[model samples]
Target: MTTSKKRKREIDDTQRVSFALSDQPVTQLGPVLAHFPSIKPTKSTSFKCYKTQTQKPMIDNEDMPFAEIPMLVAGETEAVDFYSSEETRRGSLGSRYFVGVHNKRTGITTLRAAPLHILTHEVKALKGLQPAAVSTLQRLEARAALGETFGTKKAKLAIRAQERNKVDISAMEGVADHLQESILKNTSTLPSKEEAKASADSTRLIPQYDIDALNSSDIYPLHNMIPKPEWKALSISAYMSAGGGAERVALLPFKRSNWINDHLAIAFASPSPNKTAIKMLIYISTMIAFHKATFKDINKEVIQQKLPMVPSVVIDGLLSRFTETARGSIEARRTPEKGTMLLTHMFALCLHVDDFATDTSVLAADLSMEPAKVNMLFKTLGCKVNKLTQSDLKRLGLPDSAGEVKRAILKTPLEFPKPRTRRRA
Candidate 1:
């Protein structure tokens, strides 16, 4: 007599888990469930699970909520990047609305960010559109520290959450910019309605400043160029000076810095940096006027000529903190206001010099220097010029062909020594 055996109900099919596509282990086990049969899981709308996942205080399966997963439809990339899991399962949603994801087994929630039907990483939009929590070790450490009790130092960081979800009107322009950038970034065949609308609205929000208005002396005409208060604050920090003192003189008027420390370190104070940046900008405009370089109206030739002048100010400002150029122009890429000013100068220069080109042989004539001297100057400034072809010349804005050239060419050929007199000819 043999007893019939019953296998307890086994979870034979794959259950969703809160894992990113790149690291999800679901695919590796696909072969086990192959050929058995696949019954698609309904989105389970109007169900307890969906409501529980989206609950404010979090429910039992909070860990695997629709909001916590990353996309992982292994072969389907379209489904991965642009579509949401909810949209694919139940179909498209209305404007400014989306249904996220949740894992039944683990009870965690995550955002459904798949493009079409492919799987990708899921993220939770922290309430109020604050920074998507960066799960960095440094951040984790700081967060943990916040929970700890403090002693005499009494460290406290009060974070005030918004009362309501208000569209930041002032940041509408920035949001519009972000939306436009998002559209440009998306290279898919068909964009979602939300994406299209965002792109359109962003285009409308970012006001275009007229080039003529920017050139004009009148401010009212160029009112369109107004940026946010933050931008205004940044403009003040166009340059920065160092703080703290170096012996004898606590804060000297920037002596050339040595290896010990820099000449002027940027102060992070808003509106303006410490004395260094203020003095630096004043110094630059003053010096340029002192040298008296030809300017055919700054507003007209705003982009090219003046822009190039910016790197000088950036270089000088950095030097004010230190004696020597450190890390080359790496530091210049940062320092926001100085960077913007430099860009303006570049724009101005482009405006002034139409069809302006440079050639080593030609540069010698303008500077009244030998070819060797010109080469030396260019090389010291980290420029590379080609011996043949015209790549380097093009960078100098020089023409490719001699006949079709627009700008004047100035060259200093190597001088030839006279041959010994043939019996005093």
Candidate 2:
């Protein structure tokens, strides 16, 4: 009671330590101790503790790596674990253990590996296992016994080398005799070359109308003047059969107007008014042949004047009839071979009758083909296709300042170039 307590020592506010305050936690710190490098913990310091509640058990009851897991019924327990706790394994054995789910309503087990399982409920027992009502076991046994003897019999019936080597002269003789008889019959039935030629000549319809009497006005004179009997007998197929130069000449009249009038009349006429309209258009084409205008140009003019329209298919078919199609080209436009021949014949006829050559442009326009292609066709026909010189223009009665014009002139005893041959290496 008598000892006096020393007064508690008090530190000054100026000498006390202070800390900075923040609302958010500090995520990063500057490299203050980075230069001192890190040291890994030893085995003693990094020891694992199984006693801890945070540590997982050796075998974890985790979900398997599957899109869906089989759900158990309310009262039912899950299936027993497929893997042992002692075994150091990863992933799952659920796929192997749970083959499939059984549908109670359908009574069908829908399996994951159905293809591998291959359920054969439809396959019946072998005949040996269960004999048919009609076939008794004794009969089956007898058949089985006969199989060996049948195989042996087949083997014995097979021809040996010696027997196979022997020639059957009688059979060969019979075959030869049959062949000889057939040959004799064929030869007897066949007509002689001269007889065949005579028959062909008789079948061919000779031009009945006088060529001298024909004029430009007579567009399809051969078909128009000839009777149906003779007209039908004028075989285009026979003319085309010769092909090459002869075919070109024979088919010239067909390209003019005869072919369409004769054959295509039925095609156009089936649809009534088209026939008359198409024929009028063709007549107009013939009338305006000297104008150097294309069929398309004519069509355009007709359309502008509110005339009957021709179908594109009909026009295409007409073009195909008078043109040779180009092979192996992106632009499948046809070459105006038949058309050029037709023009050539018309030009030659004009030269014979009117005593003058025709212009290439006029021929091209008449055929509704390019003038360049028409000129090429003329050259192929052994004609001289040349640009109009001043003299040529003057002879043709064109003005001195007339633009470039190409003319095709026929020469006597014309020599044609050999056809080009494609070479493959």
Candidate 3:
């Protein structure tokens, strides 16, 4: 035989062997298939099928791994429906297939999943309707967006009609004439010249301290001679209403029966007498009596001493709970209406020294306030301003020739001015 014919015969024999191996079972031809690129050996030897049965037969109860299967059913087969024909026949659709429904009562448009036939019916109905003008469409859209209904528009129109039909009494000429007549009647009822003069005379007879009507200087001088540390400590204590201790007695001399002796003892203590302390004590006492003190009244002393003032935050806190600004002036005094126990106790010294009828001049001298201003404060407290005449001076053991001097006499059953009532027209 020729060499070419021999090579062709060898190639045909190899092809026949491969074709024979491909026809055998995978398990039997495992090693032979592994050598071929087209056939791969799987890692697992478990049985598998690409085409699976849709319906599964229920397994026997004895074949189940768990003996006590609570909800097991044996010998029953389940058939699966792939096309969902039941849902289609029932006219139920998913959320993606929805239609907008407008509620006339609520004036709200809501989307709901609807069947295909209902959607087709709505489309046909809309097609049969006449096209709206641009202006009319815009107006309807605006009303829908604003949730304005026909009933609401009707209510608004009814209100406008009512307003138009109503008469305005203030605009009528007869009403104006009636108002003019009333004004003339009111003017006629006013007091006559003689009655006015008598009223003025009666008013003069009553002693009234007209502080607002006075043309006095607002400036009140202050002299601070107290040591910085001592004054600061004392101010903080007074502001806080602190009473140190029971044993550290006689802090306020005014409270004791022997107040004069106590005052002298405190004024002339061991190391050195604090003359400035006495002045401050008296000033604080006056402030407590009136329940008011001004920053302008103490600003000069504070500036002169070069002491650090209390923080505005602390002052604001104090104002909220304990104090309020005095009326009539922005630079007015702050009246510590609440938490005045310590201050009142301190002020007892002044009352004791003044024999309950405080002398305005003496208080003014200590507080560096005008005598008239001090007098006004006393008058506000319902104290009677009496002139110490020759007879009065003699009775009080003073020289008769000292001349008449004014003094505020504090009396029991005090009479205060009645608050004026406002008349309504």
Candidate 4:
């Protein structure tokens, strides 16, 4: 087993250094370097930015491209090393970027540090660092990992055994009959009746919902149609709305609503007092106020931060629900067909999977759905969850490396359920 370190000072890897640089050297400017044309250019007093410009070819109308900075003598690595070796304020732009001075005649390039924006961007730490997991496990882990237990070897062993299998054990059932006598001998060390009574009485069972106990958020009603940008980016399903007017709007896929409401806050801001949108706003707002208090895991704190026109996802659900529940009529009508149960169910999958609704079942049993059923659903809905082939992806013109979320909504084997129509009001 040999390492590169064994072949130390490997000179062959170093690029051949040009022998043209005199005692007075050239400086490199932004990607290009200032260079002499044919013979070295006459000295000028003007503010010469060290970067180079192309010179016309000696022959035809064609102009030759300027020489690029050499990788070994003067590119990203050399720039980085030079900055690292310098004794100055750490991580300055001068440490990173350089103006290049190229000498076409001598075939040499010199790099000089230049002031530039060593741009800093607030790149959120990517989520993949942890891998995709549902919220249920995240919460369960949070509790179990942080939970406190009595410091006892017996307790630790019991937990380990429970993890292996949920079972009850009796010492004498498997072990020696002498274990019973050992236990009897230790009975005298047990706590008194008062201690036992005190422990039993410590737990109180009472329910209280104070005025202050309200959860969820306060927000205006959301539009019945999948309102644009309210929930931020709508999923690929948004285009599913193919009918003419608002009826087409109702068919926008399940992911849009689920992502906003289940993933975020849902508020219902009212429209004008007499308007249906207003009524929707009121109903959703009230529902949000109720659900936030009851639902186990929403970030209610995030729900309250107000946006311009739309309520957060928290409130959006309520508004949509209220309109559906109220029956297409605020004044007098039937369901306007803003959305469908199938659409809702698809998004529900996202919310449930994210909340880890399926995790327990997956852990206990099998997660893979019946392939027959999946194929049937695809046949019924005329869609694909994973058309897992390079050619199919090329046909769609979608990138081969689309995200899980994209795959979830686009590639999902969802059937467009037959639309139900109401008797004309």
Better of 3 and 4 by lDDT: 3
Residue-level lDDT of model 3, residues 46-81, one tens digit each, is 221121233556555344422111121111112211
Model 1 stretches astray by more than 4 angstroms: 1-351, 356-362, 368-425
Rate residue 397 of model 4 by lDDT.
47
lDDT of 1 by residue, 1-425 (tens): 98769867766445544542323332222110111022332333111111213426543433543433223232112222111234333332332222345677764455333222322222233324745433333463565465444522333322112213434455465665677557656855577877775464334311232322332222112122222331233233323333333431222222222210231332233455444333333333322331222222222133224334233443343224212223754322223333333322322221122212224554344333477655543332222333423653565544556424323221222111222456755
lDDT of 1 at 66: 40
TM-score of 2: 0.22
Which candidate number would show the highest TM-score if scored against the true structure?
3
Give per-residue CA lDDT, model 2, range 44-150, as digits (tens). Answer: 32211111122434432233222122211111113211111211112223423223555554445543321111111111233236443332334544654565466
Worst 10 residues of 3 by lDDT: 216-225
Per-model lDDT: 0.33, 0.38, 0.39, 0.33
Q: Candidate 3's C-alpha lDDT?
A: 0.39
lDDT of 2 at 25: 22
| Model 2 pairs in collision | none
lDDT of 4: 0.33
Better model by TM-score: candidate 2 vs candidate 3: 3
Which is superior by lDDT, 1 or 3? 3
TM-score of 3: 0.26
For candidate 4, the per-residue lDDT at 295 reads: 35
TM-score of each: 0.15, 0.22, 0.26, 0.17
